[model samples]
Target: MYKLFVAGALAAGALAAQLTQVSNYNNSAKAKPGMQDITFRRPWWVYVPDAVKSDALVVAIHSCQSSAQKYFQNSKIPWKQGSDRKGYVSVWPSSTTECWDVSSRASLSHDGGGDSNAIANMIKYAVGQYKIDPKKVYVTGGSSGGMMSNVMAATYPELISAVSLYSGVPAGCFVSASGASAAWNNSCSGGQSTATAQKWGDVVRNMYPGYNGTRPKMQFWHGSVDSTLSPNNYQEEVKQWTNVFEVSQTPTESKKDTPEKNYRTDDYGPNVEAIWAVGVGHSVPSHLDASEAWFGL
Candidate 1:
């Protein structure tokens, strides 16, 4: 009878472990179990599916004026529902400031003890806690979060597999700013962040010096009429990633009115792609589906 009881208890414990639900966690730079020291004490949330069929983990970052729970629960992308069906874990992280620190040198440098490093450490925590495959980790977001996605791609190339950015700028576009002003760059957002392909690629390579390895694939999206962040930033992002991939600036494949009306796609190569959503505003939730597909989630 005792043996049967023990067996039943073990079964119940396993079942509880597999339950699907959203969990909240608080972590600081002072206590890191499996990674580098995180300088910020940011809170994060995770959505675990009932059955995690794959090893993929998607880090969904919120834009400016947004929180982790707000993005996770209120996104138009049906994040929870999609995770349930797609069998991939979703992590949402809140920014310490109003926006991600993309323009700051600390955030731009590799492990330079900024919000970016804090985020990287958080991802490492998620990987170990959930037994996630490091090679399958991905990041996606809108506006400031989108820009931070590029920051992560540049600074922590080894941690991400692919990224889908919405209304973002190129890495190091706002490097001219410092302090709190780094949170928002008027010049970069005003469409003055232009550079040659080689120059932009050099900015990314400088983030992690002497590191030659496979960089993560990238997908960039922007609303053609987005005034909040000038549409020109999209073109700059294309220049940046194409140069990193050593591909031509001209796309090999161009599709018009694809996936939706007035939405165009350009494929520079397998490693780089861009989408221009016509007549849209700063942020478009409709492209979230395509972003997930890009991550193979």
Candidate 2:
């Protein structure tokens, strides 16, 4: 079973070069005698130049109800290849289950929020097992996975240097949409009128309480046409981050000569950036070119 799972995951990676999987038993002797072992998938591509060691690592989280294979296969294409003929390692781990435990739903709230811990452990392992630069670690995700990325950044600020999210809500954010139950507090409660905006405000405030003082470099992207998660939420996220980082907002428009279409960037702080894609759906845009342009791999 484990071998099959690994083989399937690797096959998916071959298509996008953004995924890998490993199986390991829970060796904590203090636990039960025979708990089910874990088989997790993660991004394994390292964008490096030649044989030189990487100066940074990117840990990507996938969307809810989505597997690592699907997310990796759908991301910007250039990321699958490395930068300047070099590559930096990118990691993506499957959630404990098919859906992340972002809400209080009985079916989602299992694994004791080990998703973030699992990521931290993976980084630790990578540092010891591979040549990785500790100061340059970054995280990103989309949709539900995007929410998890936010949670990880908030919960483990010391472990991450920067974060980027797509069509996602903030950490610990829950909403009572048409078909969803309202279990966890909505991250958008104390913000703008739109659900997306409110959630963004709440997430930034809750996660970066000392934002007025100091915060990490951050970036966010959302499609204006995305109704599943709402593009307005990205605006609120940018507003909160800019306020926290004490940066001026200057909207700059640019056109990508690709399927991603036109987009704009808001420069918040010296290093903070937020983008709104004009016509994209809930999916990650192939135009942003994360693998090649953003991370330079």
Candidate 3:
């Protein structure tokens, strides 16, 4: 796999990153193994870049089996590469078991409402601890974490400014772990019927009943040769998000990324984009900086 690393990155070279240990949130009680306390469930970690802007924050979620700090540290396109000099604050909350509840109906409730709400409460914590810019908050992740990135944007469109994902299925591919297990075992085969896709789009809509607000911007980066999930999953995401953003099914624009790397982008609107990199597998594209460009970071 070809990894993408931008030149002149790491503005914070040799500057030790500060990671604060957070055990609770929302003024809620600490999380118990079986209890439903919302704050600090499973001992999450937070990293506020030195000289971070009061109002800019990015919540980076990790894939299943990866811890928050480790995933953030190892990301191909680490948000903190040079983001600290730009004053970007980042939060990495560990999922209780290194896996989020994104593959189910129950996952909908995991935002801002209770102590167990990982994404929402984390954002809330940012708003409380720092002067985070409401219009600049972002969420990005890989694999299952990527799925939750889409989920958080859909569920909390009002709070999240934009979302980016790599190698993830669309939201609502399955409503339970059993279904996810079955789908994963079967290579996520063919569940994306038109109806299935539309229903999944509704899962996003229902997040805000009777909502007539602006939908958050979306970006997707998928490897063309990914074998873990069906390639159809890409369209599953494109279909769901284009519907949410109210853009036409056909992209409004298309362009090649780099002639040498076989990268391309289908732009639906100023805020919606889908990227496909040829010869890449289930990992971040070598040109993920393109996604960051769209993020306007």
Candidate 4:
């Protein structure tokens, strides 16, 4: 059975939202049963609050090997009946495979075109089905899903207003030779010869285009202790997009009661900002906290 959560604010006419699962496999013939053909499977969980008036939606993407269900569970946002209400909708789309389709060095190809198109379709579906405010639509994800969120911001800037990335590298992070001139050239080659790796890194960076001015707001969060993906990539992401947005770095200090120490750096621009969550591990912080402080929710 599916899970449902509605807050008292929704009942009080402050907000109205609900959670449901959407099956995208039937939408395309490319989706085959079993393993006969490499078909694309698109399944997502949606959260809508009663307070939502129109055109305000948030798309939450999941990390590698993570499902939309788990993302919803990990999220501190209230998803059950009668909880704190925010008049908005959240949609989480699952990747057909364990990860996103950022494996290609050319054109950002995935298992099928559906991976990219499915998101657009989902947006269209939500806008039509609900009275949504298109200007306020935002996207956020972690790890592989975070990479996908960057791809979304780069490719479909018009549809999204802002993006929040948790422990996510740039889109070309997985590409063969994508970080030559930067400090990560040696590591980009995976311990291969620095000279050879640098060549590949340069090629990767050149081939892929950085975010132009016509992009949405952006936010990045990474754990300083995270060894999975080097923290340098996070810095590169900030540098590459410096021209498009006005950046700001704010160091977070420890509170009297909290033992864990963290620093937050925010890059502000016309409609975008990137927040680097330092000293933490590879995980998205509490949405209630991030929403109130960083996201301005």
Candidate 5:
């Protein structure tokens, strides 16, 4: 009886160890910060599963007024749970101010000195340190972080494979905020920012001048009724990305109730995809499964 009891206790201990949670999520992944190039305001929270398989990196940026920890701990998406199951390394990058520096010209320009450059350098360090696959690096975010995701992909197209932006405006759409606080852009967020497809594409092309390389594919998500960032930005984002990929504005394929309930999707071949969460508000629903599938993880 004593022997049996001891063996059962040992097994329970082992199971508990295997079930240890990371970032307060129910998973066997581990979380750490200060890996490389991390500063006070520009903080980072990284999660690696117990047994990594993909060797791919996913940069998950947080929404405005949210921290990396909060985003990672989000119950809706469950970052650590997905990381543990998929075996992908995930990093959560926080903004220096109220939001990422997507409005500044420095952030908009490739290799320019700003939050974008710093984040790129962090990515380089992470890639080298983790032995990550250069071809599988992806970025995703919501709201302000979503906007920064566009900036990252635009500025470092060669470094990023794809982007999943939620409720984000198009790159350069809010450049009017340059030389001002990087926090808020009244015109852009208010749905007042407008430009022709060619003009919007020109903004992205100018970010990496003279580079004719392939631009990263874009996956966009937006709540149809998102007033905080204005649902109009979604159409503008589709226009920008479609032009960048040189695809027609007309979707090659369109589907309803895809990815999630009440969510419609429009695909422009392999270059651009947009998901519209109908009747939703400031934030959309869980995009975990769809985004992972989109990243091919």
Candidate 6:
């Protein structure tokens, strides 16, 4: 009995240490714009309302020509869901050149030491410093930041709970700056097969080993009229995450309630969802109550 108790105590100690002592911290990942060694945000702004403590941390990345502060205010996330004690908190972190590298040889892999890993390091910082709940952590972004959000869901699936990607592309979509420009100009108007989707899913599954953990649920949005980004990319996002969650390739629930507005939704269980906001352009939706509801914030 004594031996069993000691073993249990040791196991608990190990878990505590693992949670408290986070590793692979990249200071550059949290740096501000215009620095010697690649910058993201300096002291990334954190929002915990009323000076209250927090239970969950929401990491939001800004698009091009935006900053952490701007994303927080303009992202339109429902922060009032907090019942008490600042039910939810948000951490806004900017990215380098307003784009997250998902295609380059450096960021597409598990140990690439790319911007994806750098962002993961940033999450570790918030989790450790704020003692936030890991299960409730989330990520969301718009445009270039949206692409990085997809990279995070793929490379750091074990770390984040769910992600809402808007106007983003699948992992390994663009390889270079010129390619990104072309994809933007052409809108990446292509479809991917289930096999291809599975291959892309493997990219995320390989990020962590021996991981029998719940995959992060995914949500996506794209404007049908968004010439900046093809709406077809939304389908690819859904397919990639559907493969990750091992759910049905076909959306179990598909609908467009507001035909006049031209908005439509395709939901593949809670693991993945895709929405097309009829005539909207390349931008984040002004009202994101659905995401807050999905997260139960």
Q: Which candidate tops lDDT?
A: 1
Model 5 scores a TM of 0.86
Worst 10 residues of 5 by lDDT: 26-35
- Badly placed stretches (over 4 Å) of model 4 are 1-18, 24-41, 50-54, 75-84, 105-114, 176-213, 246-261, 268-272, 292-296
List, residue by residue over 74-193, the lDDT tens digit for candidate 6.
Answer: 526443333233456666665555455555544544445566666777777778777888888888888877877887777677789888777877755554544231123233433232
Report lDDT (Cα) of residue 54, candidate 6. Answer: 52
User: Total clashing residue pairs per candidate?
Assistant: 1, 20, 7, 31, 0, 1
The sequence of per-residue lDDT tens digits that candidate 2 reaches over residues 105-207 is 2112222224444566666666555577777677777777676666666555666777776666545555333323223333342323343334444555554
Candidate 6 overall lDDT versus native: 0.64
Q: Could you tell which candidate, 1 or 4, scores higher by lDDT?
A: 1
Q: Model 1 RMSD to the real structure?
A: 5.8
Give stretches of model 1 more than 4 Å off.
Answer: 1-38, 179-182
Cα lDDT of candidate 4 equals 0.55
Q: Candidate 3: worst 10 consecutive residues by lDDT?
A: 179-188
Query: Relative to the true structure, how large is the alpha-carbon lDDT of every model?
Result: 0.81, 0.54, 0.67, 0.55, 0.78, 0.64
lDDT of 4 by residue, 1-297 (tens): 122334554555543344578764334434222212323346777876545543467787877777887767764433222122555677888876777655443224321243544675676677656666777777777777776777666555667777777776665555435421111333531322222233423433343345344556677776666666666666555644543343433322322212134565553443444555556666646344454334446
Estimate the lDDT of model 1: 0.81
Residue 129's C-alpha lDDT in candidate 5?
A: 70
* Model 2 TM-score on a 0 to 1 scale: 0.66
Off by over 4 Å in 2: 1-20, 24-53, 75-78, 83-85, 104-113, 175-214, 248-261, 286-297
Clashing residue pairs, backbone N/CA/C < 3 A, model 3 = 25-39, 38-115, 38-116, 54-131, 55-131, 55-132, 55-133
- Residue 291 in model 1: lDDT: 82
Q: Per-candidate TM vs. native? A: 0.86, 0.66, 0.81, 0.67, 0.86, 0.73
Cα shift from native, residue 232, model 4 (Å): 1.1
Residues 1-297 of candidate 5 have per-residue lDDT tens digits of 999999999987665412222222222212122222222134566776777888899988888888777787778655577788888888777665877877666667775666776667667766877789988899988888889899888888998898887889999777844354374778889998888999889889998798887677899899988989999999999889889888899999999999867999999999799999999987786577888878888
